[model samples]
Target chain A: MKITDPRTAATGHRVSLAVSLWLSLSVLLALVLISIAVGKYRIGPGELVTALINRLQGGDGEVPTVIETVIFQIRLPRITAAVLVGAALAAAGATYQSLFRNPLASPDILGVSAGAGLGAAAGIFLSLPVAGIQLLAFAFGSFTVLLVYVISRAVRGHDPVLVLVLAGVVMGTLAGSCISLLKYLADPYDQLPAITFWLLGSLNAVNPADMQVSLLLVGLGLVPLYLLRWRMNLMSLGDEEARALGVNAGRLRLVFIMSATLVTASAVSISGVIGWVGLMIPHIARLLVGPDFARLLPTSMLLGAAYLLGVDDLARTIGEVEIPLGILTAFLGAPFFLWLLAHSRRGWQ
Target chain B: MSIDIAGLAFGYPGHPVGSDVSLSVAPGEVLCLLGPNGSGKTTLFKTTLGLLPPLKGRIAVDGETTERWSRRRTAQHLAYVPQQHDAYFPFTVMEVVLMGRGAYVAAFATPGRHDREVAERTLRELHLLHLRDQVYSQISSGERQLTLIARALTQQPRVLIMDEPTANLDFGNQVLVLNQILRLKQAGITIMMSTHDPGQAFYCADNVAMLRDGRLLCWGPTDEVLTSANLRSVYGVDVAVVEITKTGEHPGKVCVPVMSDPRGRADSEIQAPPA
Candidate 1:
């Protein structure tokens, strides 16, 4: 009866979450629209807003055809890609935390993003087109998770922790080596630039077609986990307890592994292996709200989208040359993760 | 609610830890499975709960074979509280308890209003209502044990199976867990547990199953099965079974040898010499 009371949290918790969610989403929304306005062509907020309005309503579209093309064709796709990628990364991170029952678990740290990058690089070195590169990335990303699961299964009985982490580092290093090999083998004229750009990770390459792929991949993969959210929450308690609760750990883990990597691979394929969004966003979500999975997963999705949008804007606007989204996210995310680590230390102790 | 194990065997691929272990449990009964380290108490619990498929034998809960049921369905019928869990993230007590409702909802759906009420009532029953908001891992070991039990209670199972549920707690906490279990038994819940503590076997258990060398040495009423002779044989040591004045009927004190010194193996009663 007490739990059914809508106000589970006191006034303070409700107020803080409401304020934070509103503030974060609003700031993120503003930055996205404004970033759409100020590109290499340098349109102001008014022109950007008018163009977006017209594009939605239909007509001369708003600005000149070229300007409209720049906004609609180029900048819009990139900004949308950033938000989707961010949301996917954060959602994947939260899923990983439940998968491994460790907050430190993330797509990159577990080597999935690395494997995806390696796959993309392989595609590039082989001179495959962009669509082919996306395929390669998803394939490699999925393979990495399977191998981790296999190795963890092999070394059963010992805590799944050490074996899993070891497998990630070993596989990640192997994937990194493959990336190095691709970089070395690439033709300097045509192939090298593509491989290099893929490694750096950018929204500069994303367009409507890529956005469509992003939507398809992330949408399908996310639905299962979202529907299975309560099961995932039960699972986070640890394997035996979950089994005791009547969950098939093997099946659930397989579903989560495949699905979480689906989102990661899509994000990786389109945006080229952005880091930290997954790892840090879950921690931040947990701190704001306690670790209730129902609350935590949805909140992580929203905040991750908003946070990545803001970060990508800064990436675009920092200087004459734009910083890679991956580098910018890492720059911001790693410290927040560390700060959380320090804060969690006292509470756990 | 009751359990029927025709024959149960468990172990790794090459190394079978237990075999031909037959047992049963009836409602309002506390059954304690006792064995030394590596004798297969934990393994038996896993097999019974269907976490690990038994290498041999059949386990039936409420007259139906375990293999017949879905994991969720089986989980709804029986609940287990494990030895000691150390999760890196300290989900709150309510959050932990709410996990017991895993079987009541559609896979992946949030626990509905009724599920939450069950969890709350379970926690309240365990005297953990005030502590529900506290992080589980941050709680004292005694409280953690109680919280885990509360979580199991929320499953609304007819039978409760636990593996050394009070292992990490101190003496006072041990009493609390045992007392709570007794109350659950009074409510007609069938109880099964594996514990190394002999005092617990006689003090609270209605039936005792002693395991040795992957075999069921005995399974019957507590007084008949957990004799000083049985303890000596299984553990390869001497034991002094002392009757407590508080409960004259049940043997409450069991003094076991430190390292199983075979030097003083008296024929009839193998026990601590003089002292």
Candidate 2:
């Protein structure tokens, strides 16, 4: 009965969820709007808002053609793609970290990213079209996780999570070798640059069609995660505890792996392998709002969206030529990650 | 409801660790299981909790077969506290305790206000209400064990099964946990726990079961099953059950192992024949 009387530091366990959610959402909105305004064509905030309102009302005739094209055709697809990719990777990463009960577990827990990279590099070496390359990446990514799942299943009665991680490591090394082989075989003049660029990851080639496809797939993947968020928390406590708590740990783990894999594969297919969002955003969200998955999932998604959008904005606006997303993210993420490790004692609670 | 396990066999795949195990605990009774390392005490506990299927026999809970019961229903009847747990995420103590309400909560639903109330009450009952706000991982092992007990209590189960609940604890903390087990027995919870110390059986167990190499060696009232001979037979160590009497305190049994040599002896003395 006297529970609420505690004003101690331990009792201040979490930031108020509603307030954090609202603030993150507001910041995400502001980032999207501001990012649209800051691009090369220089659409002002006022013009952008008016054009958005006009477009929402289906009065496209009032807005100038260039402004309309810049907003809808150029920036909108890129911004939407960035947000979706960021949110998907972060959500999948958080789920992976929880599922494996390893803080080091990333979205590539099943070698999906390595498989995608290998597939994309091979596609580039063979001079495939952009769409063909993306298709190959998606196919290989999903296939790799499926193979990992199959291998883990083959070795029954052992800890499935441990088996999956081991399979992932072995398969990831295999995929990395394939990538190196492809790189070595690629033409030094044209194909090598393309292969390198794709591996480094780019949003420049992401169009409206790619955005639509990824949006649908990421949304589909996210629904089950949102529904099973609390179970994800339970699963993170390890298999025995989760089962003791009345959950079917194996079935739930399979469901989560498939869902997370779908999103990661779709995002990689579109954005080429943008790293760090999946590995770091959940930790940031955990620092903001404890480890309860119900709150952690949404918070990770919002923060990831904003963080990626801001990073992408800098990628496009900082120079004459566009920088790839992967490099910028690693540049920013690695140092921040180190800082997190340094301050971990204060923040983990 | 009391736990009623009969002819239970438990093991991992292709490895039969325990067989022909039979035990029963009545409501308000404390059952202590004594065994050596790898002697199938934990395997039997797991089988009783229905975490593992019995390889040979039937496990019934209050006259109902557990296989016919849903996980949620079984959890409502029986709760388990493992010897140790390492939680990956740093969930607060209260959140960890609230996990015990998972049985009552519907799938896809989070713990509600009523569940929180139960957790709070259980934590308070164990004198852990002040520590509820602390991070679970940051706590001492004794507090962690107590928190786990509080979590089990939140399940409101008729039977509680703990595997070596006092393992790795200081003497004071071991007594603390043992006292809590006694208190739980008084509160009408059917309690079963495993321990290496026979003295604990004498202290708290109403019934005792000794296991050795997948077989139930002895089972009966604590005083009957936990004699010096049974201890030596199960543990391969000679021990004496000595009585302790103190002023204004209840008399208790203390198990003292008979060690021939306190320090390591030279090979010559060790081989110095029957003398």
**Clashes by residue pair, model 2:** none
Q: Each model's DockQ?
A: 0.45, 0.49
Give all TM-scores, in the order shown.
0.88, 0.92
The chain A TM-scores for the candidates, taken one by one, are 0.88, 0.94
Tens digits of lDDT, candidate 1, B100-186? 888877775788899889999988888889777776776788988888888888889999888998786788989898898889888
Cα lDDT of model 2 by residue, B1-275, tens digit:
77788888889888899888887888788988999999998888888888888888899877888976767777887898998776678888998998888788777788888999999999998999988878788788999999999988898988999999999999999999999998888888999899988888888898998899999999999888877788889999777777778889988777877667658753222221111
Q: Fraction of native Cα contacts kept in each candidate?
A: 0.67, 0.53
Model 2 - which docking category?
acceptable
Candidate 1 scores a C-alpha RMSD against the true structure in Å of 4.7
TM-score of 2: 0.92
List where candidate 2 sits over 4 angstroms from the true fold. Answer: A1-7, A11-13, A53-57, A60-63, A122-128, A346-349, B262-275
